[model samples]
Target chain A: MKKRKQRVNSFMVNGLLLFLCLVWTVPTFGLLMTSFRDRDVVSKTGWWTVFTRPDQAELTLDNYEQVLSGKTITLVDSKGNQQTVKGDNLTRAFLNSLTVSIPAVVIPILIASFAAYGFAWMDFPGRKVFFILVVALLVVPLQISLIPLLRDYGRLELTGTFLAIWLAHTGFGLPLSVYLMYNYISQLPRSIIESAIIDGCSHFGVFWKLILPLSVPAIASLAIFQFLWVWNDLLVALVFIGSKPGVEVLTQRLLYLIGSRGQDWHLLCAGAFISMALPLMVFISLQRYFVRGLLAGSVKG
Target chain B: MAGVRLEKIEKTYPNGFKAVHGIDLDIRDGEFMVLVGPSGCAKSTTLRMVAGLEEISGGKVLIGDRLVNDVEPKDRDIAMVFQNYALYPHMTVYKNMSWVLKLKKKPADEIDRRVRQAADILGLTDMLDRKPKQLSGGQMQRVAVGRAIVRSPKVFLFDEPLSNLDAKLRVQMRVEISRLHTKLKNTMIYVTHDQVEAMTMGDRICVMELGRIKQVDTPTNLYRYPANTFVAGFIGSPSMNIVSARLNFDGDTCYVDSQNLHLRIPDDIGKKVRQYDGKAIYFGIRPEHIHARETNPEAADNFFNMEVSVVENMGNEVYLYFTPGNSQYIARIDPDIPVRSGDSHEMWLDTNYIHLFDGETKENLIYKPKTQ
Candidate 1:
């Protein structure tokens, strides 16, 4: 009787969860349908109305191919003279996103984990003051730095370069990354680190061989956050790399799709998917660590 | 193997809290020295200082004859087992044991040989392929010891390594660690808050409190001759019954007076308390020394009139919670000596073994008999 009762309860919970899931998935279904339909169908009828349309007639990968294969171009003027944009294809923007995100995520995490370890274990002059200062930066909106950072980058002739955006994202993301990693790393057993030291590991050796390995869950989770943040970011790219075509990220490319041609809705879905693909992979791979890391700092036996 | 010597060691944190005051201890080569105390008593801190994990605020720590104050923890060549086992969670039991050897760049076969040897000794051969989480608490603890064993360091530090295990397993691991000490015969410093662990394993025990060493002696000596009231009370379970009393010494006969009991001093040893004439002191004796009057009529030093308040029966012995006159104390009695709450009874005081401490300072005042 108890088992049956629990089963019913679980079934109710699953039903509610599926309902929530469908609520979330509706827009995604529309976008998917929008990407497949001709541009006329996307703006007039709801994408769900294509349900009566045959599978072959409704969904097509042609929008995705055009975006991925760098075939589509945007027309600049209504005189019907087409200016090649390559923005609709998403290839350049996708490559730019990888370039910006890979280093932006890696640099801050590497530096933040070191800072976290130092704050967690090492004793040094002004340790608390430095950590407090870093933590204080978390409250500063990233928008506040956009103009001043761009001005500084322009002086260095760095604005519109990938380096400018990478540096901006790292600076903006570091405080929270350090805070998260510190909370996670500090909760690790002091004994484990001490034991490694006693087992003939130096301080660096302890961090590398013991702490870094032990903190993989925390690292993976933080990487996921930073990766997704930099991947989906357009404002930073716009302010910094907006003038630079070669370095324009997918978020920028998607924005250009709207600004240049108000009617090219097909590229919107393809661009969204192109921008989302890496983050989806990252989220799936590191999702378990995300749950584990969040719980580890709060739960104790 | 080399003995560890701490001369006036101290540890003071930056917050101006002193966790370990100046302490002197000489742990003989190959002897297991246990530092036992209540929590926050600096025993763990002292052990960490020895392992070079904690820096001494003042004083010298020497292993064999070399001062190690400036040496790095890794260079100190010490092994430690932590309270929670501290086995690397990511490593298999075999890898965990062999990691230190591998770090030292020891040859693969030699590392394997040492790892296997430790596993055999710990009965952990079958568990080698498993990670720490895959094994039980006791198994994880063995792997911790195995980690220490493979290093073959000159000193071993154990910081409550068996504390996480269940009761039955703690007793079993206690014996195993003791046996490991005998076989390895390296200088070992084990820290724990458990008096039982201190009693069964230590060759010499250092009792600490707050930030100072109260006493350092063999477990037998510590139990018999605790330097102060705290050591006497802290070292034993059921604790020594300490009651406030007037110790009257009229040069010949020594007597202790309290509202609830009048206890005669036993022969021979009474001479020491005899000098404490007209002085207030704490009269102390272990519960097991106190026996039931009905079963042990001759066991009395002097008789106390009281009713039993409670009784706890263990298979071989009984713990009697009794109040004689108005003083409350526990008297451990033989199993056959039956008494329960609400029953009027008398329990004897083996006066010869009685301990006396200064009423104000709580410093021990009586001289203990020489050990056999």
Candidate 2:
């Protein structure tokens, strides 16, 4: 009876999970299908219809090509005037996003790992109080700091530069980054640090040669989070960088492609998929660092 | 190699929990000193203080003649093998062992040579390229040792380095470490809660309890002449049996009078303990000193019949546990002698090796401190 009940429970659980997965993925799958179809077909028919009658809708690469190549497309205005518009392409914006995200991720992790090492191993007066203060900063909302920071940035004439966004992101990401790195660095067997110390390793040497290398999993995992956040962020970019073609990130570019009248909404399916591509690749490739216990054989079982 | 001296060294945490209380010990040059005790005994804390891993709250620690109270661990010139091994997971065995040399800006060739020599000593030459995660527990422990020895530091400190291994492997590593000590000839201090390891490896064993040193003596002297009831009960396997009894005078002969039996205390031991006449005292004897009556006909006194409650047959010898006078005691006897649970048998206590302790202080009445 127990065996039968467990079997029934497991079957129900698997069915529920399968249902939830389909529920979550179906819309994204629909967008992917629509992204491949020609703009006219996308507007006239639902994306799911292509799966039923494969020949009903034609798949073309024109949407992606136009979005990527930055070619100008001619649009007839409502008053019937021909207006030549530069295509809302992500070519420059993609590079802009990389510039923003890479540094935003690398800067915080470098600073945070050092802060974490100090917090975890080095003994100083007010160490606990200082760590608590850093942790307390986690509760302070970024929205509250945005205005004051932007005001300062304006006075400093630093607005509309990648440096502005990088600093803003670093400040915003630091508390949690330090907290995550601290949790990983502190739990490392105290003996390893002590052993290093006894083996003639200076404090800086221990941090550089020991703590940093052992912290790859933590740094890698945090990189994925910070990179994804910075990549998808629109509010930060809009406020700091504005709609400057050269400095705008992918998310801002995608938003701009929606047009002031929302007439360009059709292009969104392809635009959104293009933005989703890198984060998907990032998550898949860097996900293995989440397989914890890199410390497995470093300490006795 | 240089000797280490701890002159009234102490450790008290910020929370005011005192871990080590004014511990004073001198470890001779090139000597192997083992600090052995039960859990919470502060043996590891004492060793950490010597290693400069822990801050000394008071007193001083000197490496050779130089005071190291404020010195950093690296500057103190010591290498420690921790209980968990603590090998760097990201580094290979060779890198782990050679890290300190590289830190000191030693030439690449010298680092390579020293690492290879240490690895060969630890039998880890073939495994040098493998990461810590790829090695087994014992192999990781060897690599940890290799990391320590590569520097050839003046002192070696070990904190229960074999406690993580299985029993057989622990014994193997025990011999291996002793052999390493013999080969290195550096002043070494080791800590463990295992008395057997203390006996087998230490040139002198320092027994501790409740953050204070109970006794420090050579292993043979420690076993034969434990300073107090705690050390007596702690140093030996199967432990010494200690029971409370009344010491009485019976017309020039003295005897221990307990619930189930009365036995004369030999004159030499009696004279030493006679000061406690008519007073409650602890009667102590080791398991090996208790024998089957058939095997020892010479000891006509101190024989009592106990129904054997448990019989442990250890092939060459047997351990028999029984209760007499409501106090449990173990007796080690030849396995060739037949003994069974629930069977009542006569056993003889060799009064020659018996110890008497003052009940209040638990200090061995017959203990004669070694004159240094």
Candidate 3:
């Protein structure tokens, strides 16, 4: 009876998980199908219709090509005025996203890892208080800092550049990055670090040769998080870099594709899928590290 | 290889808890010195101070003739094997052993040669490519040792290296480590709470308690003549039985009198303990020293009858637990002896091997051997 109950319980759990998975994937699946369907069919019926009326399974790359090439767009500015923006620079916007994200991910992680090693292992005055201050920053809302930072960036003439967004994203990502890296690095066996020290490794040598290599899983996981965050971020880019045609990221261009009236459904579907592509690939490729890194220092190997 | 010297070394934490009192010790070159003590005895603290892992709150630590108080662990040229093995989980055995040489920028061929040599010595040649997580506990421990061996450091410090293994494996590794000491011939300072390991592996054992050394002597002397009651009870398995008693001298002979037993002290021991006459003293006798009267008829000098409360058959011998008056005592008798709980038997105490401690100081008054 106990075994039968356990079997039933596990079956219910599996069923619930399957239900949740379908709830999540069904909309994405619809968007994917609609992105491939002809524009007329997408307008005429829901995306599920393609499955029943197999004859309407007409698929084309026209929407993608149109979205990728140049096209006019309408966007609402911060002062609540609608403006007509020219040039559908989707490829340029995609490159802009890459430009903003790569450094935003790499710089913060590199800096955080160094800071984490110092905070975790190196003994110096005010180490504990400084670490506590960094951790306390985790609770501070980023929204409060945006205006003051943008005002300073304006005065410094740093606004509306890829550098501004990169700096913004790195500043925003640093606290959690340091916290996560510290949690993982601090739990590393004291003996391993001591052994490295005794093995003639200086602080930088230990960090570069030992700590960094051993922290691949953690770094990969953090990279995925930071990349996806900066890639999908529309607000930070709009605030710092603006929706100017050439400087705009994929997410900002994606909003431009929607237009102010939200009537370009077919183009919106295609552009959304295009923007989703890189992050999906990244998450899939590094999903293993995600789980391993989360569990890294929680248990002893 | 270089000897290690700790001169008046001490450790006091920031919170002002003194973990190690002022200690002076000289570990000879190529010697295997074991620091044995119970938990909170600060044995590991002293070893870490010598390794330069812990800061010396006071005094000096010298490796050879060099004062290493300000030296970093790497510059001190010493290797240590931690209790948990402390192998880098990500690195293969070869990389773990050769990382030091790589850090020093040794020639590629020389690094390879030294790593292979150390691996061969540790029986880890075939496992050089395996990561620490891929190896078993013993294998990981061997890799830790191999990492230390590749450096060929002046002194090898081990902090309870075998305490994590099972009993059977612990014994096996104990002998293996002893053999490693002979083969390497480096001055080694090992810290452990197990006196058996200290006894079997150490050329000399330093017994400590409460951050103070009780006695530092060769294993035989430590066992035969412990300086105080703590060492007497700590060094031997089954422990030496201690009971409250009074030593009285009737001018002709000296006798130790406890509740239900009156034992005449042998002349050799009595002469040494005679100064404490008419004073309370702690009587200590090892379990093996008490025998069944029937086995040795010559044990007639100090004999008594008592009801056995418990009997443990250990195949070769039997342990009889009994209460004579208010004190409980254990006697190890031959297995042939017919002793059972609730049964009465005649037992003889070998006064020649007895230990008498001063009631006030708890210092061994009967046998005070010179420490080496």
Consecutive 10-residue window with the lowest summed lDDT within model 1 chain B: B363-372
lDDT: worst 10-residue window of model 3 chain B? B363-372
TM per candidate = 0.92, 0.95, 0.93
With a 3 Å backbone cut-off (N, CA, C), the pairs that clash in candidate 1 are A67-A89
Which has the higher TM-score value, candidate number 1 or candidate number 2? 2
Cα error of candidate 1 at position A279, Å: 2.0
Clashing pairs in 2: none
For model 2, the local distance difference test gives: 0.89
lDDT of 3 by residue, A1-301 (tens): 9999999999999999999999999989999888887767877888887788878778888778778876545689999999976565589889888988999999999999999999999999999999999989999988899999999999999999888988899899999999999998897778778888888889998899778977888899999999999999988998998756678888888887775677677788999999999999999998887565432221134
lDDT of 1 by residue, A150-233 (tens): 788889999888888888989999999999999988988887888887888777888887778878888998898899888888
lDDT of 1 at A111: 92
Better of 2 and 3 by DockQ: 2
lDDT of 1 by residue, B13-130 (tens): 9899988778888889998999999999989999989988888899999998999999988788788888887778777888889989988999999999999999999999998898
Which predicted model would earn the best TM-score?
Answer: 2
Model 2 segments more than 4 A misplaced: A1-16, A71-85
